[model samples]
Target: MGDNTLALAGGNDKKWSDITSQESTDINTPVSFADTKVKNVIGYDNNTETNVRVATIEDYENLRDATNREFAYGVLYGDGATETMESIEDVYEYYRIENGGRGYPESNRGMRGCFVFNTENGNNLFFPIGATGYGQRRTEHAWYGETQLGAGRLQYAWRNEEYKKKDELGYRPLFLDVYRRPGAIYWVRTIPTNPTNKNKKYCFLDINYFTFDFSPGETEPTLGTGTSACFIRCVEEIP
Candidate 1:
């Protein structure tokens, strides 16, 4: 069963036929992104204003330690109840162009600049890497288990050249979420081992106290991976 979306093998397809042939799926079963909503919903965006509750380094660290998953801030302008789009570019734009480049008030960061301050030491911070487009297409194709470059057809705003310049100057910021409902599946930055594989990865924060990954279970048993319309929720980091 290949991923029909990219006309390539799916993740599950490869899972059954292991390269090492050891059936390693059970080796390290991934834990879901834990569900721990920090009370960082700072404010509501009327137009382009970012309204995220700032989390201290302690706050975030505590959350990560407790859940084993990092916290994702909310980009407040999009329709939280639904997905931005099926295409990665469209989803990225929802936060970049539509959300005013995540432009927030200086008060949020005490005039230094927008940042996810590392509360542990209280001296470190990071900028948003951009909304990762887990959706990928083969810019070129190769056999299974081989390395191939696939253009995800998406670009993160933080990776933009201008943003890079600003980052050099220290005006860096971080990223966040989509979906209004607690248990609804939303997009996060992730994909399976093979880019050409169609069984794309998605995420959700269950109200039951854990965050988990999801994907299209099975394709048509066809030769290629399956592509389905999905949702988007951005992520940010330091390293």
Candidate 2:
């Protein structure tokens, strides 16, 4: 018989409809079909049929291997890059071009330079070394702060003092060549509770130090003044 064809008892050829006919006798007990194999089991959910399969040992191994793999630092990522980063100079050159030649002495510190690090969940997170002035946290409202920054994990770390000691959090440089200067001020995605003037205070990080204000040294930036703006590094996940 052909692989696609089926034969029933007494050597009679039968179609799928013939086998499932209402007149057919029902077999309640388990009946094994010889030489039958299936890659996935059929199931139903929410009135919908689905194909379900358990993970094989190879699947688990592949996941473990992917999780354990380390990311090569200074590697060029994103669209149309052909080479791997070979040196710190290469990283700096890439940074300069991306930053429009703005460097440390400029107000755009760390804004344009891109770096990547791996997370515990095996995601490659790409982020800038500096903050951007475009999406400045305009309100001191804590909820607004969290929603605007869109970095809940980072905000939690900043509030709980996790960044100071946790190297895996990506606040500190994972690779030696990835430059992040000490004492550089950056904004956190949180606004602390201050019943006195909640609208005036916003949180920021001075690398190892943490505080709230409109600017680094000042109590608050003049409302409508852009001085409250600080580097806001948003993270992107690479597939």
Candidate 3:
């Protein structure tokens, strides 16, 4: 059961034609970029003007608390979504998890996990650093468990990287959904884990707002991390 897309030995090979009975990707291809463009929809006017919204206090907090750089984030913003939490974080392990490097090269941090801001403490460190299965009745297995890496202490598996390959673009994506809002202004962070190491620097986003758009369950999985990744103070007007 490998991710046939990259020949990875885990995800299964489910043919697209088998599922849709189509031989070509013509139907799947988007015909018009303008049709999917986010314009006045999020607060945009026409092509020349925009009605961008100002940032609010909560927006600021969410921005400060979120990670500016991105390793693996949700394609959308909900549960059971296409690019869910479990799936996106895998993006981190591939690029950042090279041998003897900045990431968990020693694989000590555990398995496919995530980091998110929890509170606004004075020192600003109320983040969740445990398993993706914190509490409640939810739990999940690593995308590439012992199947990929040896069965080391998998308890803290959430902390370590997940893949051993790169994405389609060679470089990982920085923002999760930065282009959601056309006129509304909101952003997270992209702090470098090692300020001195420029190559390992990455972006972490804190907020996402899509005024007139609807992704439904697109963002569920990426956000399904065991804990909250952003502080998300508000979702309303700035003033």
Compose the digit string of candidate 1's lDDT tens values, residues 1-239.
12223322222333211212111123124223333322233453334333232232233324335432333333322434243244434434333122433434322111101133344555433222234422211122223322432322222111212223443445233212211112222223232233455343222211101122222222111122322222333233323
Q: Report the error of model 1 at residue 70, Å.
A: 9.0
By lDDT, the best candidate is 2
Question: Which segments of candidate 3 are over 4 A away from where they belong?
Answer: 1-37, 42-62, 65-194, 203-239
- CA lDDT scores, all candidates in order: 0.27, 0.30, 0.26
RMSD of each: 19.7, 25.2, 19.9
Q: After superposition, how far is residue 26 of candidate 1 from its true place, in Å?
A: 46
Off by over 4 Å in 2: 1-76, 85-90, 93-120, 130-185, 194-202, 205-228, 233-239
Listed per model in order, the count of residue pairs whose N, CA or C atoms clash below 3 Å is 17, 3, 34
lDDT of 3: 0.26
Residue 36 alpha-carbon offset, candidate 3, angstroms: 9.8
Residues 35-124, model 3: lDDT tens digits: 122133222223443333323333444444465422222222222234423443442222224333222222222222222333444232
TM-score of 2: 0.25
Task: Report the C-alpha displacement of residue 116, candidate 3, in angstroms.
Answer: 13
